[model samples]
Target: GPAATWDAVDAYFGPLVGEDDVLAAATTRARAAGLPEIQVSPAQGRLLQLLALTAGARRVLEVGTLGGYSTIWLARALPSDGALVTCEIDAAHAAVARESLAQAGLAGVVDIVLGPAADTLRRLVDEGVEPFDLVFVDADKPSNPVYLDLAVRLSRPGTLIVVDNTVRGGAVADAASTDPNVLGVREMVDRVVADPRLDATAVQTVGSKGYDGFVLARVR
Candidate 1:
């Protein structure tokens, strides 16, 4: 029943946001290439686009670039002069995403980096890269805390940090859990709680992707 409701909500709003042929083709390509279907749903993608637009984001950092689904959304929200850098560890995924981004006419706008995300973020920090207006972390679930720290390092005051899948079907509430993914999300939450430089909150969500939510933080 819950899933049906989420499906209904997605169906209800799907037409309002419309659809992108490039995005659809990208998903199709990823499926053909055996990439996992773990992308943010259309509604979630549009929400990301809207958030970037609302924030007037000019530069964006994405920790995951799976098929560049979400990357397309964020890139489209930016001005032509804007830039988006995304990281993916899997060479196949990065190649697929590179093609997808290029197909979306975003080849010049998005830089798809191939490597471990933690290392890439650290290098960016070491190079004194310009602060990003928004950072989206959606890669390895177990590295969320590390990614969050890196996001902070690449951000400035008022920067928005969005970490996906923080509420893994409610497993984050299990204080006794040993599952590293859940624990990773928990650790990130704890870090946010203890840190005074961020104002953040979590919103539970249900969609085609099922039950999960993201952590949204504003650097202070």
Candidate 2:
């Protein structure tokens, strides 16, 4: 389970948002094609869309590009001229994601970078790309803190930074959990809480995707 609260949130909102048959069909196809778990649930997808819109995000950075489900959500929220840069380590997955985005008519709005996420992020910084209005971190768990650092560096004041799977099925809340992923999430949370440049909060939720949690921070 990702987060119990996610279940409640989904129950409340799921009925309100009409499902997109195209997106649903895409998800089914991706699963049948043997792609590992990559699609975000409809609830989470909607949340991503809402976040992008709320931030008025013109340029967004996504630390992970799974099957492009979330990319579609984010890209759809952007203005016609807006864009998103998404990083994916697996070339095959990136290719599939590109196809998925193209199917959604959102390929033009996303730039997929295929490589180690750390290297890709560093390259973005080195290239002197403009600061992003929003950043969503959902890559390797052990590398979360490093991702957080880069996200901060690439964000301007008021920029929103959202971290997915922060709670990690409640392992994050159990002190006895020695998992490196749990420890990394704890460290990241502490760092965000103490950082003078950001205001942060964690929200727990549950849905068809199971229990999941996310940490949202606004750069000050």
Candidate 3:
């Protein structure tokens, strides 16, 4: 019942916040391409765009690109010369993303890097790519610790890193949970708190996406 209410509220407010036809078309394409419908909600995408705009993010890094729905939102926040790089492991998913981004007119500004994200991230580090103003990590939950560490390495003094799906339906609070994703979230929390280079906090969210949250950390 509550979840339905959340969805209704999201629908009610979506148009007030600019959830338009282009975003809906992206979802349609993703579904037609047989991609998982696990992308963030329209409200969430708008929130991301607002964050990037507020940060004046000229360069954004996204660890997941599921049909590029979120990537479209992030890329729209960038200036003409700005760039957003997103990582995807599946060729089919990347293909769908390419089409969606092309329709969104973000193909030129967004680069979809296909392959294992860990290797790609390491290459970017080795090549000393310019620091990202914002980094969004939403890939495999089990590798969150690794992603967190790498995201920090790619950051400058004021970079903001957002880790999605950290709460895992509130399972992260259970010390005895055996789920790998839960354990990964716990380990990520432990790692963040102990790292002197990071100042972090997590926010529990409930919406059409259900009970989950995200970790928001800033480089110190």
What's the lDDT for all of these models? 0.94, 0.85, 0.91
Each prediction's TM-score versus the true structure? 0.98, 0.92, 0.98
**lDDT by residue for model 2 (102-188), tens:** 888887889999999889889888888999999999888888888998899888999999998887777899888789888878888
Q: In candidate 2, residue 92 scores what lDDT? A: 76
lDDT per residue, candidate 3, 53-91, as tens digits? 999999999999999998998899999999999999999
Clashing pairs in 2: 1-211, 2-210, 2-211, 2-212, 3-211, 3-212, 5-205, 6-205, 6-206, 7-206
Arrange candidates by lDDT, descending: 1, 3, 2
- Stretches > 4 Å off in candidate 3: none
Q: Report the poorest 10 consecutive residues by lDDT, candidate 1.
A: 15-24
Residue 150, model 2: lDDT of: 88
Question: Any runs in candidate 1 off by more than 4 Å, and if so which?
Answer: none
Query: What is the overall TM-score of model 2 with all chains considered together?
Result: 0.92
lDDT of 2: 0.85
Q: How much RMSD separates candidate 2 from the native structure?
A: 2.5
Top candidate (lDDT): 1
